[model samples]
Target chain A: MAIEKVEYWRWTESNWKNPDIPDWHGSLITAGVDIGSTSTQAVILADGVPYAYSNMRTGSNSPDSAISAINWAMKDTGLTLEDITYTIGTGYGRVNVPFSNKTVTEITCHAKGANYIYGPTVRTILDMGGQDCKAIHCDEKGTVTSFMMNDKCAAGTGRGMEVIANLLAVSVEDIGELSFKVDEEPAPVSSTCVIFAKSEATKLMRSGWTKEKVLAAYCHAMALRVVRLLERNGMELDFAITGGIAKNVGVTRRIENIMGIKALTPTMDTQIAGALGAALIAKELVEKKRAKEG
Target chain B: MIANYGYEDGSGHYYIKIDTSKCAECTAKGCISACPEKLFATELDDFDDEVVLIKEDARNTLQTNCARCKANGEKEPCRQACESDAISFSW
Candidate 1:
C-alpha cells in the first residue's frame, strides 16, 4: 500500500509575472529570494519594478529550495539567473541561498517590502511566517528602527495554524473563512502554547463544540499572542500584515478588532514582501557598486 | 534614552538594554572589547552621539552566543566592563 498524502495544510504554490511589462531589455534586472522555514518566495525586479515572483513550499534542503523558487518565478519570462545584476537572500534560510550576492535579516526585508507593497505610509508591520511571528516599526523610508519576534514559540506562527487546519480537516486557505462562521466568538483557549492549545481543541471537540467555534477560539488566542508582540515592539500608524498569516482573514480581522486599526490592503500577494524587499535591495546594491566603480 | 536590544520569546526574555545617556558620557567604550562573543560595537546613533550597541547581526543570535557565558558560570563580562552602569541584561 502507498503512503497516504495529506493536502489539508497544503496551500497552493504559484508564480506571477507582470503581463503589462513583457520586455526587460536594457533594464537593471535583480532577484530576491526569501527562504522561509515553511515557504520560499523568489521575486524578480526590472528597473525597480516587480516583474516576476514565485511562492512555493520550502523543500528539505534550503539551497535546493532557493534554486527551485527562482527558476519557477522566471519560468517562460525569458530571464535567466545570469541576467540578474544582483540577488539578495533573506528570511530564516537567508544564509543558505547559494546564488545570492548578499543576505539580509527578515526584519529589515519585511519593513522595506511593506513600504513598497502597502505604500510609504506603512510604518508598522506584523509578519507571521511559517515558524515565527515578528512585529516591526519602520520609518517613512522603510528603515527599521525597532523590531521583535515571537522567537521561542509557535503559538502565533503559521506552523501552529497548519497543525490546527490538519486536525480540523480543513484546507488551510479555507479555515480562516470557516472560523467566522461561528454564531458568536468563543472564548480563547486556556493555553496560547500550540501543544496545549491542540489538547484544548481536542477537549472542546469531545464536549461537542463545533469545529468552527474551536477555530474561532484558536484564532482569537493566536491574534492575542500577536498583539502582545506588536504592543511590546510598539506599533505605529498605517500598519500592514505580511507572510502566510496575513492571508488568513480570521487572524487579521481579529487582530484589527483588538488593536482598533485596520490593516492596509496590498495589491499583490502579501507573502512575497520579503523577497520583493530583497530584490529592491539588490537593485540598490548594484547602483552603489556602480557608483564606487566610477 | 534607553535602547533595548534582543527579544522576548516563548522560553523567556533575553535583552541587553543600553542607557545611551550614560553611554554618551563614557569615552573609554570598554564594552566593545569585553564581550567574549564580540557582540558589542560602537557607532554614532541618530543624535550623533557615540555609544556602544549590540552588533546588528548579533541581536537575533543572542541565545546561542550568550550560552557560553552561562555555561562558564560567568554570566556577563560586558556589564562588568561598563564602569558607568550603561550596560545591563535582562535574562
Candidate 2:
C-alpha cells in the first residue's frame, strides 16, 4: 500500500461551536463522559451533532478526570456544567462519574456511538483501549446483542503497545505513522504478554529486522487479535472500528484488509463516542423525567 | 509458613535483599507473568543478563516485609514467570 499522507483537520472547540445548521432537525444539547483506564474523554452533543470534545489523562480518581474533561469542554464552548440537559457515563469507572444521572456499559455506549456516526448498518466494532479490547455486535437500533472483551490480558490491549513503545524508544504516536511506511510486513512475533512481547521484539531487532518491519508486525499482531475476536462473534457487514485503535491508520488498514470491509471512523469525535452515547442515554432519561413532571 | 520481617511501630522498617548470585541464570520467569499486581519488572541487560527487580509499588508493598521472598516454599506467580528459575525464597 502506498503511504498517502491524509491531513486530519484539528478538532478545535471553536470550529465545532459554529457548526452548519441541520436542514430541518432541531438540536438538543447533551453530554457524555467516558472514564477509560488511562484517559478520560467528554463530548457534548447539540441536536445529535457533536459540538464539543476533550480528552485528558485519567488518574486513579475517575470522577476527577470526568469532571475535569467536562469542565474543559464547557470552558471551551462557554457553557456551564448545569447547562447540559443530561449527562451519561461509561467505561471501567462509570460508577464513579459523580454528576452522571446514570451509567451505561462501555459495550452499549461504543455500539451507540459507532451507529450514530456510521448509520444503522454497522455489524462488528473493534474498540481497543489501554486496558482491554472489545469486539461488539449490535442490531440496527445500536443495541448490543453480543460482545467479547479481553480485560484480563494486557498483551491484546494498549498495554502491549506501551511496552513495545518503551523498548523501541519510540512514542506510541510515532509507531502508527512508522508502521504505515514499512516496505514489507515482517514475520509475526508471538507473545501474548507484555514482557514476553518486548523480549520477542528485542530478538527480532537483534536478528536484523528494520524498525518499520517490526512495527508493522506488531500492528498486524494486534489487529489479528482483534480480528479473531470479531470472527468469534461472527463478522457482519459494514464493520466499524472505534476506540483509540481507530486513530491508527496502519492498524485500521490491516483490519480492513482482513475483514474485507472499509472500517468507518467518525470524523467528529471518535474518542468521545462512548461519552456521547452515555449523554444520549442521559437525554432519554431526562425526557422521561420531564414527561412524569408534566 | 511464610517468613515475614517487619517492625510493629509502622514507622520505619523495610527489606531490600536479593541474592543476585542465586537469582542468576534461572530461565523460568513465572513471576514476571504471574504477578497480578505487576510489582516485578525484568529487562535484558547487554546480551543475556536478565535484570529482575521489584517495581515501585511492589517495593512499597513489600517494603517493611519480604514475606513472599523470604519463604522458600509454596507457589508464587512471580517465581513462575521467571524462566531462568533464578528467583527463589530466601530466609
Provide the lDDT at A208 for model 1: 100
Regions of model 1 farther than 4 Å from truth: A1-5, B1-14, B17-29, B32-77, B80-91
Expressed as tens digits, the lDDT of each residue in A158-260 for candidate 1 is 9999889988888999978999999899999843578998999989999999999999999999998899878876888999999999999999999999999
Best by DockQ: 1
TM-score of each: 0.85, 0.69
DockQ of each: 0.22, 0.02
Task: Judge the docking of candidate 2 as incorrect, acceptable, medium or high.
Answer: incorrect
